[model samples]
Target: MTPRSSLAATAAALLILTPTPAQAAPAYPDPQPVTGQQIIHDPTVIRLRTGGYVAYSTGGVIGARLSRDRVHWKDSGNAFAEPPAWWYEYNDTGDPWAPDLSHRDGRYWLYYAVSSWGTNHSAIGVATSPSGLPGTWTDHGKVLTSETTDHWNAIDPAVIRADGRLWMTFGSYWTGIRMVELDASTGKAVQDATVHHLATRPDLPYAVEGPYIVRHGRYYYLFASYDACCSGVDSTYKIRVGRSTSVKGPYADSTGTPMLEGGGDLLLEGHGRFVGTGGQSVFKDRGEDWLAYHYYDAEDDGTPKLGLNRLSWKADGWPVVR
Candidate 1:
């Protein structure tokens, strides 16, 4: 054999006999810089089947943007030209926040939040579209809601397929994050489905939100934002993650602390002018994982702007934004 082939064969044989060393999670990389109409909050991104990508964010009628490449973006307009009438029942302004996008059976499912700030009375609504373009969605009204008496606030919805079922997770502040099985046919919560309490922090600020779960290999990773947000530069938001073998966890961080008791591995934090990097959603584009979120731009007067980073998992199974 040639020297290169002999070296490769020997390495392969060694790998077969030697146990792989644990991989240390890499440090979070600087956010990929993108410009043009970047103001957005609670962004979720998806690649269009035709070409390019679209990101839906919180604002009047659910603001959206389009990008030919993932880096440079332009405003595509809002999902709804006019706010859905039913949304006014939950909030007078009828604006939406934290839209989650999922694809199934050649259609797109969009779940968003409707509520007045600081109130437990909130609603999570779903909209459907054959083409995930601006103004193509049909409102499906509220899939779940919360009242003053309810322990959980229904918002920031994310849907994933796990255990051969569709599940939607939503919540914020009041009682942390929650999940329930969804009816794949109707894109609604399955009737009589038990709501599963996933993660929480009962401490004073009670700040946990933006739950996004994805099943990778044998483990389900739950990603969430913790601490305060929405105050621009003063925002303290950071992204954290936990993993469990089952969808309904007892998820824990690398240190084996339960997520329900404030156990989470820190995945991303503010650096320099990027303050409060949180409200993240993970998507695979062209076979590589990417994280989409909003961060306060300290140099730009703390304007909330869209941030993107490549996500990589260690050999030990911990995710890191690199």
Candidate 2:
């Protein structure tokens, strides 16, 4: 062959041998098997001090589910018998979404969002329950709110206590993930708190939401759902994560890509019968960290269902969902 032709042939061979991005994508694992009352969305689960696990999600006035073994769930009821009168300010039906459940100061705090579809006029509300069970919660009213004029959407709240202060990470679509300080005593936003930006898409519609922060070892990790959700099998939702040394972050992924610039390491995504895995939270059980989220089950006609996975850390301290 001519030398010029040989060089062209080598270039073509290299192109043939190099894997495309899709071909090089990692094979993701399916969620551990869960049975009974698996249908859910934006699930936040925690093991109670009194024993067993309780989960709150988006539906039916903060829908509730109970699980004994963490593998079998049963629908219990709504956290509240009826919506608070103030919730009607955001939505006509008074619907709530994506609750964060945690135990602090001998009480259970539930933080959730209320808003209509496709609008930034939203509020994050707080409530307290002695047992973290359905029907026992007392609504404390709005903790934070966003008007249509605001750049950030006030939704998908996840709170963590760091440096002896309470902080909540929340946002969606409008400008991605954001954080603000909370009054520890009241579980409400600190008066005139600074809203810190965390993550976003480089493009329009942004598409990142459901921010959850967990402190693992020396780093504070930020986990957020990316792309669209709620379209059943057509949903493109996936979970991604980044880490920073400080809870109020300039977080970056494993490759040093800043989350503020739309960078995150993929932690979980759809595979096989599981589709659109996102809306995630992290909690510890028996000293082992586990991820709790909802996935659209393709085998079940794209019904959103409970998904749990144990998280194992790399030697470098990054989380890997097992």
Candidate 3:
């Protein structure tokens, strides 16, 4: 209990308890770098039942790809359904566009669009696989078709189930975002009231497609990519959003403005070597969320490719891939 001994003990205690000023909190979410596959487009990521990653995209001309990590990709090369012998248009861009996927009752369902830009002859088709990989698909025929340049048409297909109802939202140039009800068990359109627009456009991009619908918190967030996609460096793709209380319609942007009125908040724009990026699907993994999509890589010949980034939500309620 000497004075000198007590003084030494107090100094050591203060040294142990002292905190560094550099331990400040982050003002923004930390951006995570993506281990991207060069030129992979139309990214669709699924968390398998066994806690593995399965990503599909506009891969091989005849098949999809499977990947454990987001970076390395391998083509399954399994064709669940061959290009319908009926298909004749599209120049040569066959079996491309949005991929709507879900896992239900131990089975996986995939719906994709078949269309060429500027043509209303597009159709949305359904495919199923027991395992969420390629080649095991069962093409369930054409689920929906679009007007032949005469009407707002079907293109991008996005499906989500909420409130005891399964809904599919899709569209492009002709009208805009529209929805349809699907049988929970059979996965077929159930309601004749299938056609409904999700937004209003005074000057929104005419060829708006790539509709990805996800429910976050109490709001259903509809994120759609706008502008011309697949144009390499000249692409003008961007991500936009609208939220609604109902899974169905009347979704609005952050300003309480209807998405039809162009109320969506811009989530991402042209950045980095990627100029145009869209065709987004949000995925939840490892208790975190991510944005899976594609973009044109300007650094590498401005080729349209796949890009996956983690979607971090801000305090302000906007989502971004960092």
Candidate 4:
């Protein structure tokens, strides 16, 4: 071969061997369109047997909103006419945060967290309502609590039943997500229940919080919010997920990275008008799974608003927000 042709062949070989940079992951989809009474935070939504949908969120003594078509919502009122006296023990203002709503035993169970900002002295309280409507809840008091000395912060309670046993997962920035067994009859923690650590960051000031677990097929998927929240447009909150074969997980992400070691698959994040998408929960409505969360609206002065998205599953049983 000619000397010039030999050099050209060597250059072509080097080009084929050099690796190209990986493409960025696709942008997350926006929440489905919702209208009216959209302002909310850390929202937990459920369908009532009587019909329509009721959403309870963190504000105004557990604020309530009702929707007849799931597209439009109207302010209902606070879940309680007055704050339970016990709430004052944790916070002077008697303010409550993230709440989880569910139906069991022919009644509605409401679990909520009360705490002051930047402290671990928090408690998760439970209330029951026959009608699951505003102004009808009967406070049953604190289910569990955490002190400043404890490794885990008690907040963001989410419950799931697996293998005929009730389990409650709750935690915050202290150490990350932790779970404890709950007595089905009382909706409270079982005596000396095991506190299982689910996920956390390996670095200082672990920022993971707002955990919700759902049993899909043969695995339990743990969804959690990562990074700072409650800062309106400046919040860095996003959602991540991991799954385990057992309810009390050694949960790991899609790449087989364990959640305990700062591993989580990025499920969703801020995009355009929807900023700081976090504080998420999942529930089924009419046989279709839905993701209920809160996001700060960039177009509306950074007001936090309710966000709803349909959840579709892949063939591998992993969830995708549609």
lDDT of 2 by residue, 1-322 (tens): 9999999999999999998776566887778888889899999999999999999999999999999999999999999999999999999999999999999999999999999999999999999999999999999999999999999999999999999999999999998999999999999999999999999999899999999999989999999999999999999999999999999899999999999999999999999888999999999899999999999989889999999999989999999988
Which digits, one per residue and each the tens of the lDDT, describe model 1 over residues 71-173?
8999988999999898898888887989998788889999999998999789999999998988999998889888999888899999999867889988898
Best by TM-score: 4
Off by over 4 Å in 4: 2-22
Of 3 and 4, the candidate ahead on lDDT is 4
Task: Return the TM-score for each candidate structure.
Answer: 0.91, 0.93, 0.82, 0.95
lDDT of 4 by residue, 92-140 (tens): 9899999999999999999999999999999999999998999999999
Q: Where does candidate 3 have its weakest 10-residue lDDT segment?
A: 25-34
Please give the TM-score that candidate 3 achieves against the real structure. 0.82
For residues 188-223, write the lDDT of model 3, one tens digit per residue.
777564577886466644657778888878878899
Model 1 backbone overlap count: 0
Better of 2 and 3 by lDDT: 2
Worst 10 residues of 4 by lDDT: 24-33
Judged by whole-model lDDT over C-alpha atoms, candidate 3 comes out at: 0.73
Q: Rate the local accuracy (lDDT) of all candidates.
A: 0.91, 0.95, 0.73, 0.95
Worst 10 residues of 1 by lDDT: 24-33
- Off-target runs (Cα >4 Å) in candidate 3 are 1-37, 59-63, 78-81, 86-94
